[model samples]
Target: MVGLNRLSLIATLGAVSAQFQKPLLSQLDDVLLETDKTGDKPLVDTESLQAHISTESLFEHANALYELAKSSEQEFGHPTRVIGSEGHRRTLEYVAAKIDSLGDYYKSSTQAFPAVMGQVFQSRLVLGHSVPESASPMSLTPPTTGKEPVYGNLVLVDNEGCGASDYPDKLKGEIAFIKRGTCPFGTKSDFAGRAGAIAAVVFNSNPDGLSGTLGTPTPYHVPTFGLSGKDAEPIVEKLKAGEVVDSIAFIDSVVNTINTTNIIAQTVEGDQENCVMLGAHSDSVGEGPGINDDGSGSLTLLEVATHLTKFSVKNCVRFAWWAGEEEGLLGSDYYVASLPEEENKKIRLFMDYDMMGSPNFAYQVYNATNVANPTGSEQLRNLYVDWYESKGLNYTFIPFDGRSDYDAFIRNGIPGGGIATGAEGIKTEEEEAMFGGKAGDWYDPCYHQLCDDVGNVNATAWLVNTQLVAHSVATFAASFEGFPERETTKAAGVYEKDTLYHGRYLVR
Candidate 1:
C-alpha cells in the first residue's frame, strides 16, 4: 500500500506525491500536468525523474551486470554468455531479482523460447592436399563437419557461379571457384554444390578480396571458403593452365537446440492501455562476454526500471531483457508473435538499446522518424534529438533497418526508436571530429570477438546514453499525450533484412 502521508500530500497539492523539498515540489508543479481521464494516476514528468538519475547509479548498475556476466563466464568456463549457457542463465536470474526487489511496483515474468543455436566455428583450406592455409568462413550455412576434407580437382566457375550452367560437368568431384556478385554466398555455393562440385571457394568481388556472407543457412552447400581474390588468382590461373593440382577444403561447426527466456517486467500501477515498452538483448555472442554488445543496454534498462519505482507512472513502462538476439533477434520475435491482439495494441511504443558502449565510440541514434517508420516513431526520434541537443553533443543517425530487436515490434506496426554506439561499421573522419574517435577504425573494433568483455565498454559513452534512456522513459510514463496514436495494421515497407542478415545480425 502507498504511504498514507504520501497520499495526503498528493491530495493537498493536487498533483504531487514524492517527499520532495520545496524546490523540487515547485519544479514538479511547473511541469507535471493534470491527471489523465481516470485521475487516479497523475503525471511524474521527465524533470522529476531526471533529478533522480545519477551517473554514479548508472555505473553501479552497469558494473553489477558486467560482474554477473564475468562470473558466468568464469563459472562456466565458456568463452561467451550466449543464450542457454550457465552464465546467461545466471544473468537472467540477476535481472529478475533486481526487478523483484522493486517491491511489486513492477510485475515481472520470463517468456521462454526454443531455438536452433549455432555455436563456434572452425575452418581450414589445405594447400597441396597437405598443410592448411588460413581462410575466412562465410556467414550462411557453415558446413557441418567431422567429414574429411574433399581433395577435389579445381574447376573455374565464372559468371559469379549463380547458375548451374555456370559450372560445367567437368566440375564433378571438383572444387568450384566462384566470384561474389549480385546473389548471396549461400546461393552461389549451393548452386556449385548442386552442379556436382564437392566444395566451393568464393573469391572477392572487390580488389582486396573481402570475405563474404552466404546471408542465410542452407543444408545443400558443402565446405566453403571465402578467400581474397588476390589469394585465389594464382590457383585459378594454375587450374586454367590445366595444371592438375588437388586441394582439400574443410569446416567444423556446432549447431544445437537451446532453450532461453525473455524477461518482461512492467509497472503494476500504471494505465495498462498505454504501455511504454523498452528492451535490450541479454544474450552474448559465442566469441566473447558481450558486455558492450548488450550488457551495456540491458543493464541501463534495469537501472532505469529500478529507479522508476521511486515515483508513479501514468502509462505502464514495460522492460524486456531479450535472449537470442545475437543469433537472430529470436526472443523478441517470439514475444511479439505470442501477444494477443489486444495485448499487442496496448504497447504504445518500444525503444530499444543495443551496443551503446564501445571503447571507440560515437553516439548513434535510430532514424525511426524517417521514411518507412511506424506511427509515433518520429516523436521518439525527436525525444533523443532534443535530449542530445540539450547536452550539445553530436549524434549520428543510423537507419532503423531491422539490424536489431526492434524489427519484430516495428514490423507489426508498433512505433519504436533507440540508441546505439555502433557495431562493426567503420567510423568516418566526420564522426571522429564530432565524437573524437579514430577515423577509419571500426566503431567497435572488438565487436563479436573474444575481447568484448567488461573492459570493452566506454564509461562516458555508457553513462550518457543511459541517462538519456531514463529521461525518455520518464517522459512517456508521465504522459504520452504529445505522441501520436499508433496504427494496428502491419507496417508497410518495414525494415527488411538483407539477403545476408535475414532479420538476424550477420556475426562476421
Candidate 2:
C-alpha cells in the first residue's frame, strides 16, 4: 500500500489481463485505477515524517484553520467554536475532510457522544431592594425559574465553602453565601443543598471579576450564581453588621442535549494493540475565537497528521481532535468512558497539545512523570526535555492536574504526557529569564477574549511546538521500546482521579 502508485496500478491491471487471457481493462465500463498521487513524497515513518515537516507547510495550514474559524464566526454569529456551535461543527467537518483525504494512509474513525449543549441563562440575584444585576452563572448551571423566585434569608459562610461542615444549621431553608476557593463549585452547591439551602451564591475571593463554569454539571445542587468579590464585599460587610440580608435568586435557562463528534485517525500499519495517541481540543470557549488557545493546538495536530501520510509507521500513530475541552474536558471524558476495558488498554500513551502558541509563551510540559506520576510518563517527559535541550531552549513542567483533555485519559490510568505554552496565568520575571519574554505579562494576554483570533497567534511558538509534536508522533510511531504500556484495569466506569477539573487547584 505504501508504494501503490498509478504506474503500479496499471502494471497490476496488465498482469490481471494476462492471467485472464482477456483485456479486462478494455471491458471495464468505469475507470478503476487509483494512484498514490503523493509522487516522490517519502513513505511515512519516524525519520521521513520528521524530514517532511516544514515551517511553511505548518504555517499555511495554520492560516487556513484560522480562516475557517473566522468564517465560522462570520456565518454563525458566535465568536467561538464552542461545542455544538456552527464554528465547532464546521471545524470538525474541516478536520474530518482532511482525515478522509488521508484515507490512503490511515483508518479514520469517530466516536460519537452526547454532549449537554451549554445553557442559555437569563439570571439575576436581587439583594434586598436593589434592582437585580446580571449574575454570573456557574458553568453547566442548571435552570431554575418555577414561576416563583427562590426566597431565603441569605446567611454568611466561611471563605471557600469547601465542606458541608462549613454551612451552619442556620443555612436550613436559607440561601448560603459562600466564597469561592479550595473546592469545586459542585462541592459548595452540594453542601448548601444538603444543609437545606434553597440557593447558593459563590463570590470570588479575588478582585478579578468572578465568572466561570461550574466545572461540570451536578444533580445535587440548587441554582448557583458566581459574584465578583469586589461586588459582594459590601454585602458581606452588611451581613457582618447584623443585617437580615434578604435576597431572591431567579434563573431561567434552556438546556439542550446535542450530538457532537470526536475526530480520530490512525496509521494503517503497526500493532493495533499498542497505539500512541496525540490529542488537542478542537472547540473553544464561548468568549472568543480562541486561535492561540487551541486553534494552535488543533492545527498543529492537523499539520502533523497531514505529513504523516508521507510515510508508514512502525507503531500505530493515532491523532484525535476532541470537541469540548473548554467545557471541562467533556468530549474526552465521554470518549474514554465509552471505550470497553479491553479497548482502553490498547492506548500506550496520551499526549496533549493545547495553547502551545500563546503569544507570550513558555515551553511547558505536563508534569505527568512526577506529580501525577502515572506509568511510563517519564519517557514522554524525556522526549520533550531532550528535544528542547538539543535546541538550547528553555522548558519547564506544569502540573499534570488534568486541566485539559488529558483529564479523561489519566483517570483511566493511561500514562498521560503533553505540552502547553500558557494560559491566563501571568508570566513571572524568573520565567522571563528562561524563556526571554517580558515579565509580569499574561502568557496569552488574550487568553479567552475577542482578540484570540488569527492575528493573536504566536507564529514562532506555533512552529516550534508543531515540529516537536511531529517529532513525538514520529518517535512513538516508530517504537514503544522505552515507553510504558498500560496496566490491566479492574473495573470500567467513569474513571475518577484526583485531577483538578479546570486548574491545578485541588478539591477534597
Best by lDDT: 1
Model 2 lDDT per residue over 1-508, tens place: 4454445556767545476634554443223222223333333444456566666766676666666666566555657777877777778888889889876678888888887656644777887776435367676666664724788889898767886778999998888898878677778888888888888888878665566565445566777888777778888889989899899987776456788889898877777888999899888876677788788888889888887776656678889998777766778888888888888888888898888788888999877663445577777888899998988889988877668888777777777788989987889888999987778999988887878987777778888888889889888776788666577753533345554355322232
TM-score of 1: 0.82
Candidate 2 error regions (>4 Å): 1-47, 70-78, 119-135, 143-151, 157-173, 179-183, 191-196, 203-212, 215-220, 227-242, 248-253, 490-499, 503-508
Give the per-residue Cα lDDT of candidate 1 at 165. 80
State the displacement of the C-alpha of residue 232, model 2, in Å, after optimal TM-score superposition.
5.9
User: Where does the lowest 10-residue lDDT sum fall in candidate 2?
Assistant: 28-37
- Top candidate by TM-score: 1
lDDT of 1 by residue, 1-508 (tens): 1233343555666554456556665654543443333333445666666676666766676666656666655645645677877768888988898888878788889988886565435567764544434367664445534555567777888677777788898887888878767676778877877887788877775556455445445667766777776677677778778887677777776556678899999888788999999999998876777878888898888878877876778789999999988777889989988888788889999999998788879898888864566788888998999999999999989887777888888878788889999888899999999999899989998898878876788888988888888898989887878788877656434444343343444322
Q: Rate the local accuracy (lDDT) of all candidates.
A: 0.76, 0.75
Q: Indicate the residue-level lDDT of 172 in model 2.
A: 88
The Cα error of candidate 1 at residue 470, in Å, is 1.2
